[model samples]
Target: MSQIIGNLSQIGGDYDALFCDLWGCLHNGKQPYPAAVSALQQFRRAGGRVCLMTNAPRPNQYVIAQLDRMGVPRDAWDLVVSSGDAAQDAMFAGAVGRKVWHIGTEKDDGFFTDIPGEWANAPAISRVSLEEAEGIVATGPFDEANEAPEDYRARLMMARERGLVLLCANPDVVVDMGETRIYCAGALAEFYEELGGQSLYFGKPHPPVYDRARRLMDLGDEARILAVGDGIRTDVKGAQQEGIDCLFVTGGLAAEAFGPDVEDPDEELLREWLATQQMAPRYSIGRLR
Candidate 1:
């Protein structure tokens, strides 16, 4: 069961830090959510640290650049802990082998070159054809919006036959690019596993991303932390697995499922939806604010 709330302030004081999701709670893919921004600034004013924890399949700098283009102020967060950064660490450490086949677009180039300084001595990883590679690295599809997981079935079948492991950069099956829904790398990874191939994830609902956030941010050992996001399977489940409290935002990806009012969720419907889910947040809100 989950209690529906109106704003972050109602329980913000209980936590010393917030592990906030970027896509739906703080901003849409195009711009920042003003109310969410103010809530975060207030959290910081009260001496709380805000970590923009995200499952975007790009390094922190690339994400920061996108946030800048979207006009999200830097004051709203203390640091960014992203799945791309964590996955990059694994890639450099040879988790996916040295020679790999990439399934992504040019926008995802940063995943290979924009890694952290600690990996300066990392081995020189090369991009090879599917037939010549030892593993697969998926950031997203070449056509994120227009393609489906099944679109890669033929190629994936080849990789499966060769026993290539896929390193998933983002574990979100799909996300709303404003009003349009787009598939992410997680969909392909899911499809690969369904075809009997191994897929490794470094994002939400997985340990690597949370572990990376812990290593980067100093949210004091005694600090009370709360995870906030709209994705039930990713954000909420991830928080639970990490042994932390979570606040579910209904106005994001599953806005319609919670009722007609995206700003105010219908409690009965929310509870009913939760009953069907394997994971439920302790608290629920229409939006981050």
Candidate 2:
């Protein structure tokens, strides 16, 4: 049973660090949440470490630039980790071959250009048509706001028939952009799997992202770590599998399921919903604060 908590301070002392999610928990993709920023700042002030663990399909540098633009304070977090880091490692190592079909808008092109220094001798990746590609690299939809998973049914069917593997950079299915929800790379991955295509996931609820984050968040006493995020499937499930306590932020994705008030999640509804999803977070919060 996940207990509904008022704030992060209640369990702050019990943990040594936090694996925090980005989008709905810290910001709505456009700006920073003042309360959420304060909560992380307070946690840092009390000698806790914060790693901004995100499923964003871009390198840590790109994410840092985004945070800066969003006005998320530098004091709020100690380090950053991303799903792109893990997926990029595998892609460069020839997990999906050298030639691939690229999905995602021009903003996500950094994923192709921003190769880490350590992988200097990695196989060069190139973008090609679906017919000439060795594999598929899907960051997200070319147009996230207006596109749906079914829109690529025929394309995915063609890729599936070719037996090309898809490397999913981000594993989040949907994200709330302020008040509007948009599909993410995970939706396309799900669709490909439904079409009998092979899709490899490297983000939350998968071990690759957690493994990379753990390596980056190296601490002497690494046992006490808390995961704070809104995605039940991505955040809570990932933390649970990693054997860490999670602070489920109900106000983000599942705000309506709890009740009318985003600040005060209905305990009965929260418990029932967690049971239905088969996830068990030790604690729950209406928001990150």
lDDT scores for all predictions? 0.91, 0.93
Per residue, candidate 1 scores C-alpha lDDT tens digits across 37-86 of 99999999988889998989999888999999999999999999889988
Error at 79, model 2, angstroms: 0.9
Model 2 clash pairs?
A: none
**lDDT measured at residue 176 in model 1 versus the true structure, 0 to 100:** 85
Q: Lowest-scoring 10 consecutive residues by lDDT in candidate 1?
A: 214-223
Error of 1 at 271 (Å): 0.5
TM-score of each: 0.98, 0.98
lDDT, candidate 2, at 239: 94
Determine the C-alpha RMSD for candidate 2 after optimal superposition of all C-alphas.
0.9
